[model samples]
Target: MGPPKPSITISQQAFDEMVKENIDDLGMDPTEALQDAIETLTLQGVDLSGIVTCKEDPVIQSLDRLKQLNSNWTDRIGKDGDEVMDLLDKLTELCSAEGSGNAAIGTRNGGIELVCSVCSKLRGGSDQGLVSGLKTLASLLHDVQSGDTFQRSGGPKMVMAILSDISQSSNILNGGFSVVAAAATGNEIVKESFMELKIDELMLQILRTHGEGSIHSLYDAIRILLTPDDNRVVASQVYGYARRFAKTGIAEVLVESLKEGLSSPSLVSATVTLKAVAVNDEICRSIAESGGVDAVLRCIDDSGEQGNQTVARVCCSLLSKLAGSDTNKSAIVQKGGMDRLIKLAARFSDDPSVLQEVMSIISILSLRSPDNAARAIEAGAGDLAIQAMQSFPGAHQMQRNACLMIRNLVARSPENRTLLLHNEIWGLMTTTNRIFTMFKQSTFFQELLI
Candidate 1:
């Protein structure tokens, strides 16, 4: 024990091998014996790169090839053939291939690095090159495998970074928003990530700067963020997100876009997006402040004889929501919005869908506002409501809503009550009571009975 003996440990196999080598017979130190065993294993060509389990994944191998050949892939753009489509298909396949745990490999093995490099090149690249590169990135994002990876690895930031540089080129901007839209569609995580970047402002900027071509993607992106195609009720988080849109003047831009005509996709997009946020008091006020009532009324008028029923329905519903605010009700009535609505109700009296929305709006206008109630009566809304109830006798909700509106019309406006009574509205009271008694416990129905 002159010097304490050094200690070392080796795997059983290595220990046995050392023993078989007669290292103990030669009385070598334990550390020297372990060192000899390690040298033997290292010389045997064992790959110590920490990837011992997953065999040579072909997907990872192909991704590595693409990363190396990304420039070659870029050069294929503008060649005018199956080349671009082929490039897109290949990139899409690579991204999808990452799903079976290959994402981990791709993430670690330069796949995301390649995307960043492509984004960098596209920022300064020619328009054709930019379009192609952006499209490729969009398709990659559409694939579930690369979507999260793309978002987490600065993909969204890279996309946002290049947007300003490409703002002047419609093709380039459209392509950029395609990537943004794809990243946003059905992927809340990425959509929230984009929200953090104030992507809505960037979107409005696109509409402001690039004009018509950017409308589709901007609408699509906003739609995905706000409405979310699911059946779930719009949560407070979505409303909170929509407040940001209103702050960015989205409500104003949307109202102006309505000038695109009834059937215009942009027009429909604008209307629908506005409706989604109309519940916010500030947003509703913004709509009215932005001349939305007049613009919307004009759209309803423009829909004409063969008006888009869906457009009419959604616009009316939106106005109904906006009309909840007193100022909005005044704006609507002043803009002849109430007159147009009455006309629509009369014209589509047989269509329960349109009539339902009309009655709903009339009810809102009549509630808590004597002036608005008088305006509705002046617009022949009382007559229209009675007609809707009588004509759609079987339409339960229609009848209920109509009766409720009649109640609201007469609650504060004696003039309206006199107007309805003179028009034989009392003749429909029996019908109203019958319907109201059916749901007597409902506060609305109870109020209607009174």
Candidate 2:
């Protein structure tokens, strides 16, 4: 033999204990827990390449039992289907393994057949078996390799069919929606299937009546459906999607949900989704009228206190959009929104995007509502904008928004103009105006000189 094959040295007792800890303490599936334990040991410099494997007979037996139990005993498992899902998670892990080609071909094919069978069940009736099977399929798809294999086997279209099939019972719908969401994670093709089927509106309805323990799944589905992966960059705004989301009572649901003060992952998704749709004036008005302004303001304040930057960022964006409306701008001002935004601006001055949004909101307020503009001025909004423009001289949007807001403030009240001159923004304004005029130059000779 070349060199001795490396092997992991662990007592069977240690392996068992590790697996149990991962399952009970960490909430990992048993198979994953086992794999994690082995990997952890390897990372610690333990060799696992040459461990004497147990006989194949027992592993084959377990695989057989898992397939049978996932398909047949699903209905027999009690409501909520936790027990069945646990077994399926284990089965999913097994089917994706390769063991002398024995586990690879047979187990993988069996898993696909089982998913197809489960998808077929979703087409008609609803039962514990159907629900449990859908949950299992979701777990299987949670693995990237496994989901790809399933999709290649025509399971993606099947999943989409079930997602779009509104006739299914609520139980099946809940389970199916969740499965589709999990399967579609980072899978653009699956995402397209949901979009192509035009299930965005229907999914929103399901989200309104979302099941008890499936809030994440429902929210995930809605987020992915509303916000595609590619556009999740600097500008995640989609006007059409926002318009449609507003039509589906999304604003009302999100606003009302925040009112209850329930803390969940859904809040982040809701805020992000709201940001996407708040481009519409109707949605902005609805958000404020639905008390979303207050809710979002509180979220901004609370997220800052809790160091939840993501929620704070999106919540601020939502408020910025809401402030775009003339009526809502006054509402935000009366609610002390300017003070909060100013504080946030100071705290996050190092962040260009956040500063841009803050200045943009001030621009809108100063443009529409003189009273709010006065309040923003009182909050030192002029200085804040000037600082932001100075900090990011190359950011044309920030500079443009700042100059526009300063202009609006001065135009709104002679007092604000005096204040602007007092703060010494006159020089910055002159420089910015010249730069803007240079940017506006269209002639090649003028551009070359610059």
Candidate 3:
């Protein structure tokens, strides 16, 4: 009939009023309800990015302690004072414990330093814990591979100040494994329990911290926690931070900090954090899709110069997983990544290891996948890659990898395969199958002739 009348629907204002009334009847803040909903999503592994909030969590209660220390004198002394002093004493002893903390009373290259520093600072004037914490941390720094060692507690205990206190700290920024350089009495522990014991409590307490200076060791602990196995905390921590920051519908501040570290001139702990955070596929793809990859690709491309060497290495390692797909390959090429990689090879022509890494990336793209390989060739990586694989004599690892790339290019293209066959690829393989097999099973044992 006359294009049917529109169906009746409640008025927007009427509906809004009804919903608000319903929400009010529930005895809960809709804002908090929304937060609870998001946390639910996070628990289920959903992309709550841009929908969360890195709340302005006050630094831990220690701030009050610091202020109180400045306020009343005799108000907190004697047995109470002795308690503080003893804590300072025990922590100093524990912090100064060395050699991985295995032997009795031995110094450890662990979080004992962090505990010592914080407790020592708390002890103050007498500065028992401060001196011990600093000395232990410094010594541990010299021998320990990372900083997320655990002593007193897990993430929550270490980052207690970030959630509450931070005054005693001078500059507890992250360098590598989170550098907690105190003003001789502050900047302490907790990155991730990469120490003797794994922690299980107060994760929320630890993850809430998004402040600095206001806390003693947040930066240093975060840095340490982001190292390798320790880096495992990233997905949850960032997801929580993302969930918190996203509540504003603007992830700029959170993402900006993440981006700042990625783009920092110093390829230090921040850069390492970026890499760790990027490991979350959702976070990484979002970052790549959001143009973080462009910067990383730039670093990847500039890997030619010695000045950019560290950046290149970091880029290579960080971008490894991102480059595993055709779309990413295409994106990288469109973004000028291929050219830079080629240039890097040329600049470091003598450095076969660098060439090998670059070639491995190219190979990863071209592996038995014709279109991608052709795209790689079109990007001008083929000749240089081939030459690198062949130019290096001796160790067949590089040659084997090079052979595999060339072999893949051949397998993907009938013409390329024919040409390679014409070139006696069998002979090449016969020359080095053993070396190439270490790369990947699919690549090395593909039953080439069939």
Error of 2 at 374 (Å): 2.7
**lDDT per residue (tens digit) for residues 276-319 in model 1:** 66757777887877788777788777753566688788778777
The predicted structure with the larger TM-score, 1 or 3, is: 1
lDDT of 3: 0.45
Candidate 3, 1-450: lDDT as tens digits: 354453333332443354455467766576665465555545656433222122321211222343344344453442245544443334334434453332111222123433434443443343333433344344333322233333342323343433233233333212111323221112123322222122212222232343312222433343334333322233434344333223332222223333544354333433444554444445555656666566566555545544455555556655555666456766776666666777776777777666666777777767667876666566656576446645765646667557666666656566555455555555655555565456446644354454
**Superposition error at 332 for model 1 (Å):** 1.6
Top candidate by lDDT: 1
Candidate 2 segments exceeding 4 Å error:
1-157, 160-205, 211-214, 227-245, 349-353, 389-404, 411-415, 426-450
Better of 1 and 2 by TM-score: 1
Which stretches in model 1 have alpha-carbon errors above 4 Å? Answer: 1-68, 71-84, 89-149, 166-168, 185-188, 212-214, 227-240, 259-265, 276-279, 386-407, 410-438
Question: Could you give candidate 2's per-residue lDDT for residues 164-214 as a string of tens digits?
Answer: 655566667767777777666655556556556656676666665553224
In terms of TM-score, which candidate is strongest? 1
256: Cα error in model 3, Å: 5.8
